[model samples]
Target chain A: MSGFLDILYFIVPISIAYAAPLIFTAIGGVFSERSGVINIGLEGLMVMGAFVGIVFNLFFVDTFGDWTPWVSILVAMLVSAIFSLMHAVASISFRADQVVSGVAINLLGIAIALFSVKMIYGKGQTDFIQEKIPRFNIPFLQDIPVIGPMFFKSVYGSSILAVAIAILAWFIIFKTPFGLRLRSVGEHPMAADTMGIKVNRIRYIAVIISGGLAGMGGAVYAQTMTNDFGHATINGQGFMALAAMIFGKWHPIGAMGAALFFGFAQALAISSSGIPFMQNVPSVFLYILPYALTIIALAGFIGKANGPKALGDPYIKGSR
Target chain B: MSNRLINVLVPVISIILGLLVGAVVMLVSGYDPIAGYIALWNGIFGDSYAIGETIRQISPYILAGLAVAFAFRTGLFNIGVEGQLIVGWFAAAYVGMAFELPKIIHLPLALLAAAAAGAIWGLIPGLLKATLKVHEVIVTIMMNYIALHLVNALIKVVAKGGFKTDKIQDTASLRSDFLSELTDFSTLHYGIFVALFMVFIMWFILERMKLGYELKSVGFNENAAQYAGMSVKKNIVMAMVISGAFAGLGGAMEALGTFGNMSTRAGFTGIGFDGIAVALLGANTPLGVVFGASLFGSLKYGANNMPNAANIPIEIVSIVIALIIFFVACGYIIRVGLQRIGKNKEAK
Candidate 1:
């Protein structure tokens, strides 16, 4: 019985690590979508950030060694922000179709990152990181029974950060004037514009913020979870985050809940192999649980999840 | 008169600019960009073999691009082409493995099954969009994942411990090795002929058929189309079915002619998504899709050779393609450059 409990303990922490990257990204989607820019490029941006973060961490660790994670995380955020500026230029400035422009950004991001990584590394993947984040047991609290180990003892620093960021994201999305304006733009940009808000500028800010957070998510995944970078490392995580965002009904807290649920499903899928009854079930089915859940969520099985009214519609000045 | 010439020349000029950018990247990386481009050109068009490879690559693009282009003409975004392609691939492959019959019947039967499979895959999004007013983009994106996992599950069940299916029967297979004997084993098959036929059929259907007119009218404006007595819902669903059928045929070509079996590789083949770029670049016309697919195929085939010859990564080709798409989509940037050129000419 304790052995079963031990397995459960192992599953929760590892699952949370996998969920951390997605939580940040889903929150990023919340910011972008709330501001009415449908950022399909979130996937591409996360991929870019994953590559840059790992590469930066590699070099920084080669030199500074100890301060590598902080340096690499900052560099990843900066790179993602710079990368997202292209989407801003295309969608916000040029007034192109937000979805199409986002797709272009995604294509450009992946192409550029993969091309450069191949040029520098001589392959499509990067060398594994020598230094990786290890499990940290919190002082005093780790000694508690049952829930304590699952919450703090077995959890990664990045997982803790994801939860903290979720709270901060909730505060920002609901408690701030900027958040109100962002939601106003997404819900009705023309109304916000008439109210003297700089709609496009706000949208740009939202997109950039999204990119930065997603970059951090990528960095955390690299530094904490995988400790390596490859062309396929960020495969569909961004899309999964998008699904989570939709599943959670586009709210930050809701998205975090959805992310955790997805993370648990993934963890359960993998960990279930150890359970006697589920031993025969193929593990691949769990790999697709999040996506399956997304369809179910969208099909009205989860009730009506309304996106922002002005989502995906490009804003044109002086148009009705 | 010359100014009008420049307007037509701009897309060509953009292509040149994209190539030059690719060239500059190659030079910076210590490879001869000119040699790389030359090698790419040769690999795609230099000999009968290379040309056949190019055509082989373009076969699916022609169909997938048509899939996307057809939907676009109906004012629908069939982002589910990837899903449709997978279902079509599995359908064709399953039929190929399940039956043994005369070539006269098996080949056409497999092809038709592939088309019907794609059509069924496409119908889900069409129904949702037409009835529930759900966005096709989201539904299509979701369907891609569904198709991937569902097929993967099916493959696991039917493949009997192997990741791939058994080799398709000779009756079901569409090999061109015999034709290759005449053309020095160029690897081109009857698929190219089929693809070309599709181009003609698509052109005829979109131009001559009343249903096609309704689809186009709906694309332009649903209100106007409905006022013109066209059923928007029916056309939307029909457009998706036709698009799905095209993608299905594309998958059949790949399964029967190329891979000869169904297997998972890296998640999903990007060919269907790449069709989006091709259709957009080709301006979504049948002839244009062929041209765009050929261009893209040439670049991809060349990129594979570049790593061996120039020591440059194959991913740069994707970069070049992306850049070209970016430049073309930002038509205002080109117009601005053209305007400045005209002003300079006037001053002279």
Candidate 2:
């Protein structure tokens, strides 16, 4: 029992760090998809965010020092919003296939990042980031016995911000006029249009917002998990976030919970050797456990779940 | 414009625009676009060796493209082709090593093993899509990561941390010394013939067969096909299985002909993802996929040498590919532009 407590102490903090990015990106998916535009380009958008965030941090770290991470997140978000406009125009305005457009963005995002790195350094890689986001514990709460040390110790600001943002997102989606219009567009665009709501306009904004949040998610992963931006920095974290969104039934709070579950699985996989008995499991099995779980989880959602009714269909005016 | 002209012109225009944007990116980065393109051309077509390499590269692309195109014709999106291809790749390699049969028997047997393996992998998602109505796009993407990691684990177990497996027996190998000599010592093999044969099969099935007509009708309208007494569920599963067979052939070509060995991959080969673009570019036809696959193959083959020759990033080739696909997706915009020009001509 003592041994198990020690393992939990290590796993809890690490899982939250992993969960922060997934939660943010999953929330983005909920927004775009709930607005009737499925943003499969989250992976690409996240990569861009990771790239810009690190590059911006490197450029300004000397001048801004420790405060660079927060500013870089904002920069990445802005850049990502602009980058996703291409998807918005292609899918919504030019009437392109949403999946195809998303794939295009994915390809472009990675290529552009790689090409820029090559152009800047005349090589396939960039320099590693030296300054990282600082971890902190709550002041007096740190003295509180078991719950404090397990949860609040060595915490990332990004994780706390993620929970807050999720709460804010839940409120915006469930309790606000803007979210009502957004849901209406996703459910029935013609019905929403007749009621003086602009479907295309809402979709464009929703996609941009999704892009911005996913970018920040990428930034968070780079800052906390990898501490560097490279080809492999983001890996498949964005797709995992998408799986969380689906698993959560497109609800913000639900997605956050799903993200936490995936993060715990990931933390378990990486740290299994440190815990007794788990060392017997093959490392390869652990590596694949999260992805296999994601597939099973999505399959589980099949009978009960329904995505936005107008999802994947472009809105056309006066075409009842 | 005639339908045939539009069909040809759309891809041509898309390619030109893709190249133009690639050139602009190069210029903005202070590189000479003309020099880079010249290097690209020379890298792919300058010598018999380059030509052979390009054709060698084209082999798997053709089959993968067909896999995607075939599924599209059945109104099913089969993004799981990557997973199927990897499973087939490993299956072919496994059979080649495990068996000790006659040359003729072993080669065909390995290829069959690959196709069967891919077909089974594809069947899972197809059943889910048909019965549960779960989207293939999400299912396949998740499956892809699972396939990669599973293969990685298996390869480690089989090879005992070797990271790469040994070359297959000579009987299972597709490499032909005669074909390589004919191409002046390049990696070209008999896989090209096999790929072309598959294309011919695709064309014959879709254009000439009874079952092909039913598949096409089903693809065009699922409800209509159902009302007309066709089994949508059966057709969906069949389409995915057949599509997986083609992607499996692509994997076999890579395992037997090109590499002749299996190695742990860091990520997907990107051949399957690129196949989606190839299918769209080909207008989802076998003959069109041939054209798209060839173009893509040449670009990829050339990209390997572009960085050394012109001081340009090899990623430019992929950027060009993405741009081409984007332009194809936005084909309507170009069509509208052309229609406006035609109207002005009429006004004049």
Candidate number achieving the greatest lDDT relative to the actual structure: 2
**What is the alpha-carbon lDDT for the whole of candidate 1?**
0.82
Candidates' lDDT values, in order? 0.82, 0.88
Candidate 2, B131-229: lDDT as tens digits: 888788888888778878888888877788889777889999999999899889999999999899999999988899977887888899999999999
Error (Å) of candidate 2 at residue B321 is 0.5
User: Where is model 2 more than 4 Å wrong at Cα?
Assistant: A300-303
Question: Best-fitting candidate, measured by TM-score?
Answer: 2
TM-score of candidate 1 to 2 decimals: 0.94
Error of 1 at A127 (Å): 1.5
RMSD (Å) of each candidate, 1 decimal: 2.4, 1.5
TM-score chain B for all models. 0.93, 0.97
Model 2: colliding residue pairs? none
